[model samples]
Target: MKEKKEKWYKRLEMPDAFVIIFSIVLLAAVLSYLIPAGTFVREEVDGVTRVIPGSYTYVESNPANVLDLFVSIQKGMIDTANIIFLILIVGGIVKIIEYTGAIDAGINVLIQKTKGRYMVLITLVALTFGILASMGLVANAVIAFVPIGIALARNLKLDAIIGVSMIYLGYYAGMVAGIFDPVVLVFAQTIAELPLFSGMTLRVFIFIGMILSVIIFTNRYAKKVKNDPSKSILGNRPFNDDEGITNIEPPKFTVLHGINLLIFVGYLGFFIWGAFTRSWGINELVGVFLMMGFTVGFVSRISPNKFVKIFIEGARGITYGALVVGLARAVVIILENSQILDTIVNATLVPLQAMPTYIGGLMLFVFNLLFNFLVTSGTGQAAIVMPLMVPITDVIGITRQTGVLAFILGDGITNIVAPTSGVLMAVLAVGGVKWTDWLKFVWPILLSWIVIGTLALLYALVTGYGPY
Candidate 1:
């Protein structure tokens, strides 16, 4: 009956992220009653909570009732409040920039400026946006850039799908590559009890490689489509003029647009500086974007009331992702409060203790890949998985840094193909590409990531990459 129901459910569309996460929270609560209750000693390290090994002990089973399950979602939101608000501020900034016509205007100038150098345009845009995404500042925010990319591709006689891939793939790669992505990197590292941003050197190289692969893939597809239109993934599916491409003259490059572009680009520079030199956290990151939103709105002469409306709408649009992050937290809360997380870890790890180190690390990488399809939010993935895996890796002699690496790699690679990934589907819809076409096009890249990542994990294990 359970298998039949799951198959029937699979035939239906995925539920809301919140619903899926909440269900997992309930399932975890149920497991607490079924599994023996246990915990590890914990202590503060660098102002973060960490489980102390060799402290595992059986505890009284404290099962949650239905009421406790219902309230854990609220607790989830409260715990993830910092990240949830950070997402809102960033969303508002992107929305106001869209309202200002700056995003379109800047892309218009880019198309005009880079005309006839289609490869240059693809490489430049992909790498630039990829870098921004790597910093965790501008990944989902690229939704607004999708139409602009399609417009540029159509005008250049390239496939609309290539245009969308340019943004989505680059961001996805950077996200998984995890160079300077504060949200995932900080969450995973802190949970694993590694120094913040440890193992940056290896990640930077991997980041460059992934960015380059996207550039190559996008450029190749773009060139093929440029040479033959019928071969385009978007064949015969007519795109509307307002979808961004038209016979009308592209918007003129004006002084106001130029200043707005400078401000946008200049702010990125300022952000990078602050991030590296000043050790900026969530608060500083949010403040910078808040200022960017107001500055762009004021400079473009958007009325304060209209600006307020846009900001609210922007925040509202991203509320789903923000809330899902918190609701996902409830899963962790349920497992922790039940006092059985360490038992799950130890029971699983003790059996694998004798395995070769590289294989053990690869197992983690593979586990993260499978786990990511279910929990798509990077923050949430870290919140639940990292704590369980951290001690297991220590017991098995795999470094915490390697564990975090596997988690991110596994998490990122699957998002490209997972139907459960809201962002992937959302990006495809914005680009007018079908998920079927995307899957066919993306399989090679995904396979390459798996191979490369497994090798990287083995290397990290052999080298004992650490700040442990």
Candidate 2:
């Protein structure tokens, strides 16, 4: 019955694709306006409660003014530029690696050894490298591995979508669960004013658990698709035999391959050492990636001029993603400047204040999920929400750490499907899957993960894991 229902739904003709995309965008815009601001009040010894003001004030007098719109647009453009520069630098290095076939060579060896159990291979590859990609080298991990995933799936008679989904699942799970992720860690710690690395042990456990769950779930899902072609998320179309599994003439492993391998190894080793030792920061990691790209390009006999061309190509691929990030940031800026963030929060949480502390934590978890769609960056969202939440958590008798944990879960889970998330779109494009198709496949998986994760958050509260 379930299978028949799914098949029936799949057969229903989708409306104009543009309508679906437009509706989603319009819904996001509507939600941005409708969601009330979050605010909290402080009490004095005189038994009077004061209403806390928000960061930005909503302009009722001149709502449709052109000057204000221009200023907002300008700020959005500047933010986009900043993000593009970062993407260009990172993408350039990864492109050089790709152009030289270093990543392909490494993946080929792994695929050859794995042979028949392709699903296990896909899961393992994603889980192992996903964590590595979280450390500021965003584009490298996805660009290098996603194509390999597609190729591998083709060979196994599996749909390319499964491989694409697993690969991204790994990257995103790692990005969100990262204990040392520069953006997330810095954002959370700075906002909470806690010591950097204070929550390392707990975070590490969560990261490992999530990674394991992803691998297990991905493997099971992929296997089901393999056994039942009709179940394949990308559709059970026959594999294209013309796309050869191996290069007709595999590139000979030369001294250049060895050199490239060493460069890759050393590049990752330096960051691992720095993270474990707490000796460096995100800037250092960025510097290392830039240096490694050039080193690998030169060692692989890529001429400087040609290497620059590859860099340009790679940077071009990320331009769309960069723009999405910028536009998403604009929405956040508008909410911040309008002081509407407080209004949204206060309206939502004030009624919840009478509830138990654990309930308040649950409320935050839900709020974070919705707000994250507009503010995709974990660190940025934390800065906006934590201050308001901390005082509220105190009043409601929840620990600050529990509040932060809720923020982490909320911020982490939404990135997987959030339309504003550049990484999500990048992964989808690389895998040749449409955004709607990807969403159709992963919605159930995401919902399941959220339910499990929420239970974990509740457990933390019950056990008094942090200061409540």
Please name the candidate that would achieve the greatest TM-score relative to the true structure: 2
Worst window of 10 by summed lDDT in candidate 1: 238-247
- TM-score of candidate 1 on Cα atoms, chains taken together: 0.69
Model 2 ranges off by over 4 Å? 1-77, 85-95, 129-168, 171-209, 224-250, 268-294, 303-322, 337-339, 426-434
lDDT of 2: 0.63
For all predicted structures, in order, the TM-scores are 0.69, 0.71
The predictions' CA RMSDs to the true structure, in order, are 6.6, 6.8
- Distance from true location, Cα of 385 in model 2, Å: 1.6
lDDT of 1 by residue, 305-404 (tens): 9998998876776565566566666877787788777677556544555667777778888777976765677876665567777767887888888889
What is model 2's C-alpha RMSD?
A: 6.8
lDDT scores for all predictions?
A: 0.73, 0.63
- Candidate 1 C-alpha error for residue 298, in Å: 2.5
